[model samples]
Target: MRDNAILVVVARFLIPLVMLFGLYVQFHGEYSPGGGFQAGVLFASAWILFVFIYGLDTGLRVIPQRVIYALASLGVLLYALVGLLGVALGGRFLDFDPLLDAPKAAQQTGIILVEFGVGVTVAAVVMLIFLLFARRRADTVAAGLDPDAADDVREEQQ
Candidate 1:
């Protein structure tokens, strides 16, 4: 993998652009079709591309397993906290009407926060799934077993 200089160089240039686009999709979602789901996929894709190009070990080094787990939990907590805070403020769950003095501002703030939470959770989960599968493949190959065969065995059991 290290010998592939062209792939390494191209990934270095493209990954940041992909991330920026993901952020755009996330922040601009309130006014556009894209939102947390799209942004999360984009972000996960960027990291997936990185892992595909650079290897899973490198990807894990950049973002550890514990960090991914924490991010997944934090995202859900963030979303729940926002809704609970609204309730505490005397509004219905997720109402966001009392978050700020101006109802419109509060709504906007609430939407953005919820969207961000969704994005974070989605991205973390996708990454976690990919990592798990990648690890399984690596282990299978290491054990001299056919990964496809392993998949077939699991499917047959199911």
Candidate 2:
């Protein structure tokens, strides 16, 4: 994808930092207002920024859709598994006491794990949405059509 040289350099430096911040938010959520949902979106937003400035194909090649889908499913599964642990221990859903035999530290650990799962799923889903929209726009452009053109122009010729 072609972009101004300065913008490319800036993005290269910024994206990694943004990803790191997301990780921090995910891990430190227990003591802060930010948590899985916010961290996930932030992580996905960095990727979206890259895609928007460069192109969808570049983004797809960097992070394939299949991988994203897998990650999303895995995240949900992880969260469900954690909750199941609580159920197996004869507690209500997501009850942390069962996670570690009623130890507060263990319960905190369980919560962190579940929160990470949520963050992963949310991030992957958001990225997937951005990918879909960007890909559609790229397709339209490749067909020699402006995305914002009138509906009549976008219609296929008989």
lDDT of 2 at 20: 92
lDDT of 1 by residue, 38-153 (tens): 99989999999999998898999999999999999998999999999999999989989989999899999999999999999999999999999999887885675896876776
RMSD of each candidate? 5.8, 4.6
The parts of candidate 2 lying over 4 Å away from their true place are: 142-158
Please, what is the whole-model Cα lDDT of each candidate in the order they appear?
A: 0.92, 0.86
Candidate 1 structure lDDT:
0.92
lDDT of 2 by residue, 1-158 (tens): 34488888888899999999998899889998888998999999998988866887788898889999999999999999999888998887888887676589767988898999999999999998887776787678678677554354557432
User: Runs in model 1 with CA error above 4 Å?
Assistant: 147-158
lDDT of 2 at 15: 90
Task: Report the lDDT of model 2 for residue 47.
Answer: 88
Name the best candidate (by TM-score). 1
Model 2: how far residue 84 lies from native, Å: 0.9
Residue 90 alpha-carbon offset, candidate 1, angstroms = 0.8
